[model samples]
Target: MAATRACLVALVVALTFLFMEGRVTAEPTSAGSLVQRRREMGSLLRRLNKPPIASIQSPDGDVIDCVHISKQPAFDHPLLKNHTIQMRPSYNPRGMHHDSNITTHAITQIWHQNGTCPENTIPIRRTKEEDLLRASSIRRFGKKMPRSIPHLNPTNDTDTPNILRGHQHAVASAQYDKCYGTKSTFNLWKPWIARGNDFSLTQFWITGGSYNGNNLNTIEAGWQVYPNLYSDSNTRLFIYWTRDAYQSTGCYNLLCSGFIQTSNQITIGGSISPMSTYGGTQYDIDILVWKDQAGGNWWLQVGGDYVGYWPSSIFSYLADSASTIMWGGEVFSPDAGQTSTHMGSGHFPNEGFGKASHIKNIQVVDSSNCLNPTSDVGFITEQNNCYNVQSDTYGDWGTYIYYGGPGNNHNCP
Candidate 1:
């Protein structure tokens, strides 16, 4: 009985050991199997839920949006290809929010058809009144007119007669002897004068014709001080011409006629026809000086208006001693066939005949000082009396009056 009992006890101990070993091994295997099943199920679910690779089209070109997954089960799947993903119409968060009601394909089509993404669309606003005003101002005055004339060759003493004399006949429509005088008073005959030893009366000339055998028409002549003459330290020159009136209509009408050549050969601004003229009032032409800051250079502006400007080089020519400056008769060439005929009909009109151009003021100012003060006053003021002068009989005034101003004076009406 004792041996049997001992054997039973041993068997029971073996069974217990076996059962413990089975439990230990089976626990790990079962757990591992469950984990593997879970992983497979997750992958299948991801595949079922995964969006298809989509091709996107834009007006600019084509692009692709694709999904990708890692082969390693340890890594999570990614919706887009690594580093290969591109911007597409559907991916824009803002566009998605704004266009929630619209179809994704429609939104994509809009972007593609537009050539750019819809999020980038922006509406251009209209210009405001202030902007319009600013633009108008720019259009009116910002742009500058280009220079019309170029520098001319230097003039010598001999060339003076040919230029001045020929211009006298052509300009005056007649021929007359050149003379010099100091009388401040106006004269119809011998209308030129040479001041001091350095300046000659040949510097001035006069030309005109008889209108209806009544009004004696005349234009003054002068040599443009060559560009070289302005350099002479000893040369301090003053030139003057006069217009007198028998009546208000008789004085030389500056608006109707006047011209001046610059030392550089460029013609300063003058009127081919009356821009402004008061028959009895005297108008004076003078040279104004200017300097450019860039090169520290000087320029002479003729006729007060910006129409004519001469560089220091041209000023030097005018100041040179080798050239004889002529004024009055056409300082250029004579108009072909008009010279003798103009001289023959020398009728001085009692009402509109010989009148003098008066010099009321003289001033020297920088280029900035030469600005047109009434630039914003509009066309009426510009076309009229912006120069503080009145209109002429012909009702036309050149741009000079607006530029050449007695600023606030309305002397010529």
Candidate 2:
């Protein structure tokens, strides 16, 4: 029995050696050792099921998140030779509104690179010194500044008289008397009716008339300041009426007729039409200034619409400087025998009457300045058009030649 026990012990030792060497072995003789081995095998299997850890970086070079591959093999493990380290980066892959630390230079760089701005990015530029200086000058001198000429504001204070009535009456009587149903004769050489150096005048009236069955004698009537004297040709400024009842047809008709004159002459004319074909409404009584372009050329614009243009060959002479100005009340047609009956013979019942229209403010603008002011360029002459009627009013319309009222002051007796 002792020999049998010895043989059994030897067999168990051999089996233990074979098991430790990873070879197939018989049952273990010690149950405690077998239990310990089984526990260790379980621990190894559990570790194999755990994930592997991976590190990821953000775009800004910051460490974002760390992930553990619990089920995948380790990167350097020999058993994972057929598998690759997939390494899906752990990151907050979502959009963000990044408004912090934004700089102009950085934005410029981005624009240069992308050729366009990104969404929600507004591009801003620094103002130049010259632009600042020009703006400041305009503010100081109002419309007197050359750069603020296009944006000249309309004046209030209807009392001031800048239109020369006598001159306008003479021209109208000579040009459209027959069409206006009047027989008055206009004397162009009258000393009192001649234009001054400034080309300013008062003493005019707005007239409305009809010719040859058609109402062609309609115009915004007022004294016009031309760039020269002795001719009803070129003008600089025109002051007329502002009453809404007489404005609609008269304003547009004057735009069509007066736009034919080719020179730097400002023509003030109107009509009494109660309706207009342009829109279906009557316009407020208003004045218009026809700006003569370089060649006997001219442009007719009212409020903001560019109504018409005249070629340069129509005028006898063109006014080059703003200083050479004349004042008159009427406009003459060189070709009286034209197809339109109102073209000639100043004795029309509608042409020669000098009735006063409800006059309003005067406007002075510098054409030399190309910049448009903040004010509405078209509606400058309408009522309540000034910024400040008290102080800014005088700057826009000019002070009254005599008494200070509204429409009454527009005439120089």
Best by TM-score: 2
Error of 1 at 284 (Å): 5.0
TM-score of each: 0.20, 0.21
Q: Write the per-residue lDDT of candidate 1 for residues 316-380, one digit (tens) a residue.
A: 21221111111121111122112221110121122232232211111122223231111111111
Q: Give the Cα lDDT of each candidate.
A: 0.21, 0.23
Worst 10 residues of 2 by lDDT: 180-189
> Model 2, 1-413: lDDT tens per residue?
78755754654565555446433334445745544544544444343223313222322221211213222212223333344322211111122112143221110111122222222221211112222122212122111111111111125222222122111121111121111111111111111212121122222222222212222222222233332221222211232221122222112211211122211111122111221112122122222333332232234333322323322222122122121111122321111111111101112222221211111233222343121111221211111110001111233222111111111111212
lDDT of 2 at 75: 23
Compare the candidates by lDDT and give the number of the best one. Answer: 2
